[model samples]
Target: MTDQAPAPAINADRLWSRHMEMARIGPVEETGNCRLALTPEDVEARNLFARWCREAGMELTSDRAANMFARREGRDPARAAVAAGSHLDTQPHGGRFDGVSGVLTALEVIETLKDAGIETDAPLMVVNWTNEEGVRFGPGILGSAWFAGRIDDATLDDIRATDGARFAEEAAASGWRGTATPADLPMEAFFELHIEQGPMLEQAGADIGVVDAVQGLCWLDVAVTGMDAHAGTTPLPARRDALLAAAAMLVGINDMGRASGEDARVSVGRLKTATEGPSTVVGASEFVIDIRHPDQAMIAHLQEECRRVCAEVARRYGCGVEVSQRFAIPPTAFDGGCVAAVEAAAQALQLPYRRMASGALHDAANVAAHAPTSMIFVPCRDGISHNVAEYASREHLAAGANVLLRAMLAKAG
Candidate 1:
């Protein structure tokens, strides 16, 4: 970190204005956006972003995954670019700042440097990763996962969107897909600026959150089977109701999570019964359990406990149960250097900040596998996010962006 170098101030008004402008592409409830990945709405957002980047004198490029990169040349052309960004796609009912702020702040950072006539040793890049919300696509953070080599080309191309469109077809249709791969545009470091998405920072009255880690997540699929019977004819003691058994399992799962520890999180977001008729007992039931923890071992332990609870509940209710692991992302500890750079930036700026772990999964988690990566979180009102009411004050956003600017400068040098 340079103590004497002049610090260029980011245009807070411009950043806020850009967010308002992007929200127009897929307007929802005036404050919400529904731009799903690879949709026409998403393409429009990308095009507008590209236009802004070009106007800022940054060259635009995209990879096979359609991860858009806006590059500003540095003093050394050969150095790997120091990157800052987050995904641009929003949840079906997402607020404006979740992923949008990261990409915009990255652009804001470089633009500020340009305004100050200051250049770094390595090129700076602003990235807009694709399919981060995954509302239209199946798995979230699709772009960064591919860039990190977690998903192969064939698998990526074969993926089908919820609207019956193939991933490859949609990427090509967007006109942003290119032959560039991660190998072509390497990164020295990646910083993702995002809303806290949780209430800790705002409740604590902190100006910034220097994120040090991201929690692990796991999904489990459970299927309970039993014979359907006439609701009126079957006696309560003789009936083997799959739905009833599933309900019991749900309660058991919640109880188990509560007993494990405060950090453990278990939730059942999706559940279905084979029989929807009110007069008939459900023959089969299925549900997905979402489990998360900051500790990988705790995640595993919690997973096993859930399985045991389901099996025991099934046996008690005379139903057959099957539990299988769907997918799991282990807890990620960010690079020490990257974490320190963000913390140092906060210290240099003399902002009130705290070192915290992200409770939500982010594209940075996948990027961390390939590059030195960390995140800076701005406090959202009431710690609310992913909702129409989601908001980060201009002052807090500016404070976080300034921290991001300093962090990127430290890494780029």
Candidate 2:
């Protein structure tokens, strides 16, 4: 068989410009962005994306969960489509590239295919999954969750934002909630291009990453309640301090994960205590613990230990404790075939790639459950994410997008 033509010459300058312009929407000068899911800024970004898709002659559609799909029909309209893209929602202070690059790259891929006058056997689609950040809604991958039937309408309707705003109300106000169902569309394969969100590629001196699996994640919100007393008047042994118990639990959780080995990580990112008065002992304290591991059994073990530790700490402090699961997603491995395709594409392009597991949870983790899914990762500057300083080089971006383009073309063809 004759070899396929070389990958099209991607317009790096144009791509970077597009990314910069979009980044400015919810921009926070030194920090990254704050376009929380379903917020007004998020709505503005979606509108701009739809407009961009229309300019490229791609038909756009929104599902009931507010997931957006931009489509470019192929030779056979009846077959399942080859799809690519990522989420648009940002964390509280997320960087620009985390989710936006995947989306813009997918759009660029379609533009490249059209400009090259190439036709595939199946339709191509770019997706923008809503609430992937989960900063506002509490659950990440909200769109994909609803699409996969993992989340229902009633549950989604009841989800409230950090501002106590109802999800459905905001979606309707933005005019994004549509009649289409996520599962109604036929998808043959799904691919996502993203930043490594870690230092893997940069540290290894590699240009790209072909993700093999995503680590399992369990997010728990723990609350410790104790009797409030005067800090100066109450003896240390007599006080039932909630904050102290919480601090002990945090340290215990970290120690547990550290002892478990390299794949385990525990983070207590948010902490709140009742009664902001400095002199008053804390009556109640709540914190969010995010635990992740690639091994399912290990994650379970860690979680159990955490629960036991919390109970013990509460007992020691004479406080009541409660743990709630905010989010739980099992470890997910990418399709072997899709992984092979990405590897082959990298080899063809003479690029260096390493097989790595994603430490950060992504929408792809959810999609992989129901579809043959894989992801390509570019390197970030300092393995930083969910911040304004998150950055990736232009060369890395182009390389990742090219891999995405080739992989999608191969699958569609």
Candidate 3:
């Protein structure tokens, strides 16, 4: 390890204060927040974030994808910027800190450096990625994907949210769009500090989490078809029961998830039946299976297993089944050197931390495709997120920010 200059400390109180203030934008009865991507609430959050960065004396820029960056230049004009931050958008029922915490922590890093008037070898950038939640219009991480060149102009423009509002129109409606292209985001390194959104850290009583990689994710939409029949007249032995088959499939899906061990994650997030009347036997069923695993091959294998299970269950129930995998992203591994910085930062602070992998998809995963990237995780209450019950302590939030500050400074220097 190289001897490095000590980074300036951040103000915990100020950080917490800013967090509460930001939470007020879309508060849900005082417990959580809700700011859907590219909506009016999203625009409100972006404007405030830009104002805060401006107050910190940072120059702001937006990309064609509408991703925001607050830049603090370095002594060497030729070096790539060292970046930190995450998205500011939230799920419809998201907690205050899910994505917002990462954005604020990065801003705190920039503010701490600016307050100290410190200059480094490379420019520093604090980014606020757009639309990470896809709650409005998604496949989430659209902003980061576009900035990384994984998405093209036509596709990005064609995206529509639940309200049928085009992504291009909504992004432009925010008025934060920039003329810069993906070519402008070639950073030397990027870091993100976010809440774990899981119980692991809290369960282990760790103060910080050094994230090494993110799990691959796949979305499966399953449907079962059967003949509709009258509940009074259909014989139990003769009738094909779609609902019963669907219940069996759900149990089978849970079993498949368990076969992958503790590292794998799977859940059925949504389900719908075709019939409305109680007397009529359900004719069809549709549901979505969400899965995450560190290994790409394992995730694929599990998908296949799910398909096989669905087929067998359908045959037993005398029904037809179809499974459609609509979306997938392979697992992402962070840069080892960048991850080391996070670990070192935690060690230097004497904060209890565990080296772990992120189960949730993050903007950092997308940034990793373009530059060296890593992440910091703090504990949230009960490992719950994207809901009104999500919670994290002020002290835990500050600890993660301080860790982010040191790691980011090392990269910037």
lDDT of each: 0.92, 0.87, 0.88
Task: Report how far residue 218 has shifted in candidate 3, in Å.
Answer: 1.7
Residue 285 lDDT in candidate 2? 97
TM-score of 2: 0.85
Off by over 4 Å in 1: 226-230, 233-235
Per-residue lDDT tens digits for candidate 1, residues 351-387, read 9999988999999999998899999999999878889
Q: Residues 1-413, candidate 2: write the lDDT tens digits.
A: 01456668566776788899889888886648889888889999999999989998899888778889999998899888899989888887789898999999999888887787877888999999999988888678888888888888999888998899998888788778888765667788899999988887888988989998999989889999998999888999998899999999898888887888877888999999997999999999999988898888988888888898899989988999999888777899899988888889888888999988888878888788667999999999989887889998888888888898888888888
Clash totals for all models, in order? 0, 2, 1
Better of 2 and 3 by lDDT: 3
> What's the C-alpha lDDT at position 319 in model 3?
89
Comparing 1 and 3 on lDDT, the stronger one: 1
Q: What ordering of candidates by lDDT runs from best to worst? A: 1, 3, 2
TM-score against native, each model:
0.93, 0.85, 0.93
The candidate with the higher lDDT, 1 or 2, is: 1
Q: What is the C-alpha RMSD of each candidate to the true structure, in Å?
A: 2.1, 3.4, 2.2
Model 3 per-residue lDDT at 238: 77
- Model 3 ranges with Cα > 4 A deviation: 1-4
